[model samples]
Target: MFEQFFPNGMLHYLAGGLLIGAGVSFIFLMTGLVSGTSTFFSSAWSYFSTLPFFRQKSFLESRQWRLAFALGLALGGFAFLLTLGNGQAASTGVQWWRLLAGGALAGFGARMAGGCTSGHGICGLSSLQLPSLAAVITFLTTAIITAHAVQLAGVLP
Candidate 1:
């Protein structure tokens, strides 16, 4: 009964969600910050480091935690992929150029929209902010359209 209910790794997703919620709540309680990953990364980007967009004094001040969280996230994903052993299974098998283009588009979209999906979708939506709702809706709609378009173009397997 329990296995069926949690079959095909449902429990892992629940655990991941619990971990994300706890981490966000902890960061908010400790720093009074919104725990936005895109914001943190923007604060540390080498090219953007000298740019005004990322040079706010307060953003520079809390560099320690932001770097820690960013590195931790990257490390965690790498470790998880190693543990999974079949990480290639997650690939869409699209050409590398197409993947790079998609990533660039996503980055541009995130910047233009003020924040990335996790910022708006997870944190903002959880706080019941209308802006977050709008961002999430837009993100999902674009994602759906993109996916279908790629499939229709015979680019997706």
Candidate 2:
């Protein structure tokens, strides 16, 4: 039964996962930077808030730069997803509202938590930071509880 759904994409999944892990590790290793989704959001926030002439900046004023950056990131992420052969799992026919709501919640949580899953999960854990380990444990616990609660409530499909 699971054969039809899973097929034989184990190698692709392994390779894609390895590529992402290696890429993020290499980025941290080389630049001492964390390559995670939070970084992009943080950069966006900083660009809009910290700059004295943020409003005067072309990217901030028109948002064209932000749009272009998002497009590029989407395309690049799509390429990465496609290479994984798990693209079928990407589309769940979910509505945009659900995603937006989730994104907003996550954004707020990341801010309140002082960092995001990527910041703490990938970079922090890789660096063997105790806080990151705690963060990861808390994140997983929250996810499990929320998922089970949502499923039990039948609020989501």
Candidate 3:
């Protein structure tokens, strides 16, 4: 049954999930801070932008560790490519403009929602937050509809 759904096997997915859970748990235990990439992005802007929103004390104070977290995320992917992948980056075959547009849309949605999937789905849900439950429901619903619509349009990539 597992093979029927994940022909490549589930070890990697399981390992990744365990690692993520451990990392977030460690961060929370150590600092009492929720580890979420969306806030990291906003915190990072504090370094480069003079705008009041970016200059908030919360962003200013957290930007350093958030920068390190962001770097680790990038380096972790590179390390995975080097050690586990084909040692070459694979392209998704999507146009650059499409990728950019999709990223923009996702960022806008994340901001509007006050958090991203990782924030709400992982940390917030784990903490039994009601708002996160609602947000995750909406996220999953929209994702399912969009995915089916895309497949119906024969754009599967």
Candidate 4:
């Protein structure tokens, strides 16, 4: 007894989307901050750690709230995977170095784009910005091309 149009737990996707929307909206409402994890994470190093990167400004300030927000995002994701996902997801069969390389490339891409998926796809789109629209389109197109290329190259399962 399942829905014809929504087979294989389609409701779960809807629920997840609603939760994301609510969470982002709540963050903006309560803190007047966009729920952009990438920026928060990049800025988080200043609060609990010190680095020469601060030389440009020669300043030290606190952004503990950003740290908390980033933590909450991580915890929420882990919780979801642990609970609803039964702590299981498909493996990419990639080695640690490969994963690190992928992450580095993604970070580079985000930097060039001035934001990550969360900033562009979620918050910026919600604000109905044309730049966000373009960014999202580029992100999706790149993802699709990369996925197909990887599959064709037999690099992933």
Candidate 5:
């Protein structure tokens, strides 16, 4: 049954999920902070922007560890490329403009919702937050609708 949906195997997905859950749990346990990537961008902007919003105490106080977290995410991907990825670059076959637009929309949505999927879906949901539950439902519904729409449009590359 699993093979029918995941032709490439499901072990990697399971392993990645486990690692993410464990990493988030460890960060929370040690610092009482929810490790969410969406806020990392704002925290990073604190380094260059002197705007009051960017200079918030929360952003400044958490920027250092967030930088390390971002670095770890980058290094992890690089390590994967060097190892399991066979060092070959992969392509999604989508146009760059489309990707950019999609990313911008996602970022905007994340900000409006007060967090990204990782923030709400993983950390918030684990803590039994009501907002996270609603956000997750919305996120999943939007994703499903968008995916179906895209497929129906036959614009796949």
Candidate 6:
């Protein structure tokens, strides 16, 4: 029983989670920026937008760099899909539409909530802010309820 559950394993996950927490804590301590997923995506979007040449450059113009970047993102996405597919065998599975919808929802939610989960939960908690604590509690509580509701509605089955 222990071997079955621990095959891919728990130690690595615990270590990785600790490292990520430490890194997020360090980021808050040093830069005061939230180590949230939305913040990272926003920063990446900003960086990519500033690089106009990346958009203008054709595949032939910057063949190697373009190919490498595209391949890297594709492989990363593919791996994520594979993991999700394996873990949630009964689900409808990954879809591009779901990605787009999720992105839009996250962007809207981040704006409305005043901060994304990372900004409020990790950074805000690290900074010992009362508002962030409240936000995190509300966010998590709502998430749990919403997840349950969705499952009950057969939206995620």
Task: Candidate 1: list runs displaced more than 4 Å.
Answer: 1-9, 46-49, 78-92
Per-residue accuracy of model 6 over 49-103 as CA lDDT, tens digit each? 7565334433234344334444554675566568855644344565676568867
Name the top TM-score candidate.
5
lDDT of each: 0.78, 0.67, 0.85, 0.75, 0.88, 0.62
Candidates ranked by TM-score, best first? 5, 3, 4, 1, 2, 6
Better of 1 and 3 by TM-score: 3
> What would you estimate as the lDDT of candidate 4?
0.75
* lDDT tens digits, residue span 1-157, model 5: 6689998899999999999899898888898888888888888899999899989999999999989988988898898889989998766888787699889989879977978889898989998999999999999999899878977888673
Clashes of each: 0, 0, 0, 0, 0, 0
State TM-scores per candidate.
0.76, 0.66, 0.88, 0.77, 0.89, 0.53
Tens digits of lDDT, candidate 4, 14-132: 89899999999998889787766665545655655667663224123325566777789878988878998798863566767658986888877875686788889988898999998
Which pairs of residues collide in model 2?
A: none
Off by over 4 Å in 2: 1-10, 50-73, 80-90
Give candidate 6's error at residue 112 in angstroms. 2.7
**Model 3 poorest ten-residue lDDT run:** 90-99
Compared with the true structure, model 5 gives a TM-score of: 0.89
Ranking by lDDT: 5, 3, 1, 4, 2, 6
Best by lDDT: 5
Which residue pairs collide, candidate 3?
none
Candidate 6 scores a C-alpha RMSD against the true structure in Å of: 9.1
